[model samples]
Target: MKLPVLYTFRRCPYAMRARISMYYSKISYEHREILLKERPKKLYQLSPKGTVPVLNLPDGKVIDESLDIMKWSVSVNDPDSWYVNNIDHQLEIISINDKEFKKWLDRYKYHDRYPEYSVEYYRGKCEKILDNFEKILDSEKFLFSNNISLSDIALLPFVRQFSNVDIIWFRNRFINLSGWMDELIGMDIFQAMMKKFEIWNPFGKGEEVIFNN
Candidate 1:
């Protein structure tokens, strides 16, 4: 039987991370495109934590967090490889991605909110993460393993968001890391999954748009 669907908002960094991981995992689901400003009752019911990228599992279980969704999907589809193979390494990268990188990313993206924080201060914090990554990326294709592992997949959406906050600066400063991104987004799965869809036009049963998977 098909799993109970995924409700996603296309442009959300959290949703983007979930979708990309789903793509990599070869997991397909009913894709309900939701408008964040007007989240559907079905999604609100599934996860009153009320976040985008909510996954309604077959047994009526729900996972509302993006990182949790990535872990769940990878555990099922890419287990013993992308994530499960090198457990400790996979964990360490996720720790930095969620904690250090995300903190700096948020501050950098919304420096206006943190009036006491200068863009340089936040950018410096974010740059430090990138610099650490550059050392690894300079040698391997991904952070955890040579191939695209859960660590790479998990950190990417946030990194993409963080870089875009100052595109020119990022592009110039991180020329070496361009290939790392190019390799991930270059996948047919990633490209096909990221396509923009129109607002809620709720599809009928069996009419779910599965993003070409």
Candidate 2:
């Protein structure tokens, strides 16, 4: 029997999170690696707003939002107890991650486009939130507690992107945050989710990429 199809772009942090959730939950799905510039016609038919990490359920339902995809993945099977926590705080942290910090991240990564400020200025803007995350890691193994949770998975990819922007500076300044992030990134699940796949062509009826635990 055919499983659900998951459309994803390997480099997108949002898509990374969605893939991480599904992989960690041990959900079976057909992975469709799509190029952002040349999206598949089937994807546009399912979601006009066309984005990566779009999951088409076997029942014909489509989930486009990355966070929604993560929630649905864990809802179906949370093997690591990712949802067993203070739901409110988890949601609050992820909200800030996806909204406010992401703004600074975009500006920092593409400071040339947003030439209103120096790249340093945008990097400084991001530190406001990074400082808080640093403090969190200073005390706990994960965001809310020692064990992994939804908030940790949701926020790490963005932080990873930030660290990559200035690796030397990030390594020098964010000792605690780096350590916390390193442990998560080093895990088997992260490695598996990051495996490369060829760009999918719907018309070819090619073999599907299957992600598993």
Q: Show where candidate 1 strays beyond 4 Å.
A: 201-213
The per-model lDDT (C-alpha) reads 0.79, 0.90
Q: How accurate is candidate 1 locally (lDDT)?
A: 0.79
Residue 12, candidate 2: C-alpha displacement in angstroms: 0.6
Predictions: Cα RMSD each? 2.5, 1.5
lDDT of 1 by residue, 10-68 (tens): 87878888988887777867777889888777777887778898988888899999888
The stretch of ten residues in a row with the least summed lDDT in candidate 2 is 204-213
Q: What's the true lDDT of residue 22 in model 2?
A: 87
Model 2: per-residue Cα lDDT over 1-213, one tens digit each:
678889899999999999899889888888888899999999899999998879999999999999999999999999779998899889999999989999999999999999999999999989989999889888899888899998899998999999999989999999988998999999998998999988887876533546444
Separately for all candidates shown, the number of backbone clashes (residues 3 or more apart, or on different chains) is: 0, 0
